[model samples]
Target: MTEFLGSVWWMIVSLGLLVTIHEFGHYWVARRCGIKVLRFSVGFGKPLWSRRDRHGTEFAIAAIPLGGYVKMLDEREVEVHPHERGQAFNHKTVWQRIAVVAAGPLANLLLCMLLLWAMFVIGKQDYSATVGRATGMAQAAGLQGGERIVSVDGRSVATVGEASMALTAAAMDRHDVTLQVVDAQERQHQRVLPLSQLPAGFDERRVAPLAGINWQFWLQPALVDRLVDDSAVRGVLQPGDLIVAVDGERIDAADQVYPAVQALGKRGGPGMIDLLRGGERLALEVTPRQGLDGNRQPVWQLGIGFSESHAPAYDTVLKYGAFAAVPVAIGETGRMAADSLGMMRRIVTGSASLQNVSGPVTIARVANVSAQRGLDWFLQFLALLSLSLCIINLLPIPVLDGGHLLYYLIELVKGSPLSERAMAAGQFVGLALLAGLMGLAFYNDILGLVTR
Candidate 1:
């Protein structure tokens, strides 16, 4: 219940802030173009708070926090008096109309850069991109555990998030990527991930696992945390003991201990368990109890609690000076924009899954999670969201800012406005497309919740 409230609160805050900035952009541009702005609203529905400016423009905060709008005086929507005809939005020149219509998306673009700049200046904590285990394609490519990823396809990456994004983008295109890695011994090597070999209809969400890469951050050590009351090693082992070897097989990782003990059970004999306890090395003999597992399969049972830790130390910080962060932020935004455009192209070409589309529920949950992480994380999330808003609003679809600009451009080209019938037809089509898009987003969100 607490989590639900947090999600709702954060979603409201995020959407309200972004929508206000967007509407303010339109209002500002419209006023500069000598147009009469009727209202600048942060949300829809009944106004909860409102104040009219000296110019008779009402500034309002409405009940609904989902979206916002800037309503301007337009002759098309309402009859203008002779004295106020020049102030109507529809009376403005096509170029002025274009500028007024384009301002909202431009504001979001600027906001994205500013947010990212602040995020970089504050520094984001992250785990190193080190591989813990390799299998299938990764193993076949000579990738090994304990190697830290240095770069992917010539792009340097320091954290798992960066590596994942680069890899996922390439995977979507079914393109092989080159990797640079440094082993634990500081030996550098080059390898190729044959992403092109991925089977048809592969899951885009499971990029890392599908590529056979397991991160070291998720791999726990071989430390014993708990023992069951009826456990075979209950007398020999205690909590806090680090398992060193089992039956002469080295046990550096927790996963290695299970198979080694199972092999001992298969041999039908007592096995030596070498362990480190209280700075002292000891070897104890323990006989395993063979049993039918949950699936009714014969297996050995150790009965040791091996759950992962709740907290882990962040080993890296992506930070920069205030001035230095500007260029980095710009570059980051450009890269993200390009990647987003590429994803759209892939989706249109049917090369990408529609599951990538997410609705407000997913956004709210992620916003809450990111906010809980730290300020830097939340800023980064906001930056990405802002950039997405800018891109989406700029798409050449009717009823959007880009759509208004499109009509103005066509008017400029043909030396006249579109017929009212044509404009109305376009509005109907736009509303249908927008509704379908919203429905798809909601469906994806619900599907995700149900699956989880």
Candidate 2:
């Protein structure tokens, strides 16, 4: 419950920051264009607090934090005073109106770039892909125990984390991925393995499962950063114990250990016993507990904590002054933007499933997890979210920036404004599309929760 509450709080904060920035873009530009802004709100629904500035623009924080809007004086409304005609939004030229409409998305993009630059300037820790140790039958796959992986699929990998990400991407498509590995003898070898052929029982927790690759990338153990009193792992597991195995299954990595434990309880076991306490190998048993009220569904619980150790160490770290960060920020932001556009195109072309569509619940979960990981992870997550916001808002749909742009273009070509009734119809269509998409996203979230 505490974790959930924390996630909700973070979600609110993130949304508030992004929405304020986005709306402020429009508000500032509209004001500069000589439009009379009636309200500049940080959220939707009823105002929680409001104050009017000297320019008569009402600045407000609204009840709902999910979104925000700006209301400008418009001559199209019957309530517009004759004297206010010059300040009306509808009285603005097409170019001016387009500028106001485009500013919000543009602001989101700018914020994303700035955040990326900040991350680059701060310098993030990097991990190498060398295996410090390897064990079990899987260890005998022509891989020297101390081999270091330098690249995958022709992409340069500076860290173990990068290698893992690249391998996972390759595995999803069952593609044959090439790896450049150097052994303890310093002998370099290039191997091509079909990622889809990776072993099924390979631990996904320690390293991402290669579709066909048997070699496991190592990760540091999970350390107990915090523990819930009601958590099953709390009493049974200690903070310093390095998880070795669950129910006799050799735990090769941190990711492998917890899921294997959870799977044991999920399969209707009372709980699996495990060894920990480092070299001492103390044995402990855990039990499953029902989540959320007496729902009677059992999940693995062991009241203990684990922290990661043996993370890859970087030899060189890059940091930048504010002035030097701009170019780096621009490059990173462009990469992220391009990636998002590609993914959207794939999904639209039927290469991706609708199930990939995530709503607020998934986003909140991601935000929580990213926050737990570290500040760098959180910043990366926010960058991706910002890109999504920019792209989605610019989609040529009604009730969005793109929809307004469409109207402007039509007016420009037709030499007259669209009929009020026609505009209303377009709005209706846009609203319907928006609502339907929201419903689908909500449904997907529910499905995920239930399945979990």
Candidate 3:
């Protein structure tokens, strides 16, 4: 319950901040174009709080927190006084209207860059993209353990997070990617990973794992930190034991222990566990036990818990001075924008799964989790969210800022405004499309929760 409330609160705060900036973009541009703005609202529905500005514009916070709008004086929506006719939005030139409509998304794009700049200045700490283990396709592609990934498809990546983003995007589109990696000898090598070979309908969230790549920072030593109360190996294994081998297969990482034990359990026999304790090598026989996992599924267990203190420390930080970060931020924003657009295209072309569509629930949970991680992480999340808003709003759909811009573009080409009947029809179509999109997003969110 506490987690749920935190998610809701953070979601509201994130959306509120982004929406205000977006609406302010519209309001500022409209005012600059000599349009009389009647209401500057942060949300829809009844106004929860409102105040009249000196210019007679009402500033308000409304009940709904999902979105916001800036209401301007338009001759189509209301009667404008003869003296104020020049300030009416509908009476503005087509070019002026286009600018006003496009400003909201443009504002979000600017906000994204600003947030990324702040994040870079603060520095994002993460693990280096070094390979600790390689199997299947990764091994086939000559990705070796101890090699550090330098770039993916010619785009340099400094951290595991950056590499993952690039790799996932490419994987979604089933595109082959080239990796530049450096070995311990400081020799650089290039390898092509045929992500195009990945099976269709693969889970979007697990691309890295599915690609058979595991990072060094994730490989915990198979050292027993503690044992569960009913541990099957409690008598055979001690807390200070360093597990060396299981069933004759060498065990290097704690993650390797589970699959080894599960195989032992399936064989219906005792397995030999090799360990080193107090400068002595010992081998013990222990039978695997069936236990319920977090999802209540039956799984083999040795019932050993790894220590959090044993986890690898962050080895990389992406930081720059305020002056240096500006260009980096702009470059990063451009890269992100391109990736987002590409993913959208892939989804539309049926190359990507609709499961990638996330709604408010996913946004809220991610926001809260990111905020908890660190200020840099939260800022990065906000930047990404802001970028997404910019791209989504710029899509040519009715009832959106992009839709308005589209209509204005048509007016420009035709030398007159679209008839009210045509505009209304577009609005209805826009609303229906928007509704369907929201429904799909919600459905994906619910499905994710259920599966988790």
Which stretches of candidate 2 lie above 4 Å from their native place?
126-190, 193-208, 212-318
Clashes of 3: 0
Full-model lDDT, candidate 2? 0.74
What's the CA RMSD for each of the models? 1.8, 8.3, 3.2
Per-residue lDDT tens digits for candidate 2, residues 1-452, read 97888788778877888889889999999999999999998888999999999999999999999889999998676478888888999998999999999999999999998777777778755556776554332243444446777888787776666676666545444466777889878899876655566555343323333232233334565544556787876677766666677776766566676577677766765655555565686666666664543476554555454554555445434467888989978977775676567556745775445666889998888888888867776787787788788899999898999899999999999988899999999999999999989998999899989988
Strongest candidate by lDDT: 3
Worst ten-residue run, lDDT, model 2? Answer: 205-214
lDDT (0-100) at residue 195 of candidate 2?
52
Which portions of model 3 show Cα errors greater than 4 Å?
228-236, 259-312
lDDT of 1 by residue, 257-333 (tens): 88998999989879889999999999998888887778999899777766577365788899999999999999999
How many steric overlaps does candidate 2 have?
28
Candidate 1 achieves a global lDDT of 0.89
Q: For each predicted model, how many residue pairs clash, with residues at least 3 apart or on different chains? A: 0, 28, 0
TM-score of 1: 0.95
For model 1, the stretches where C-alpha displacement exceeds 4 angstroms are 279-282, 292-297
Candidate rank order under TM-score: 1, 3, 2
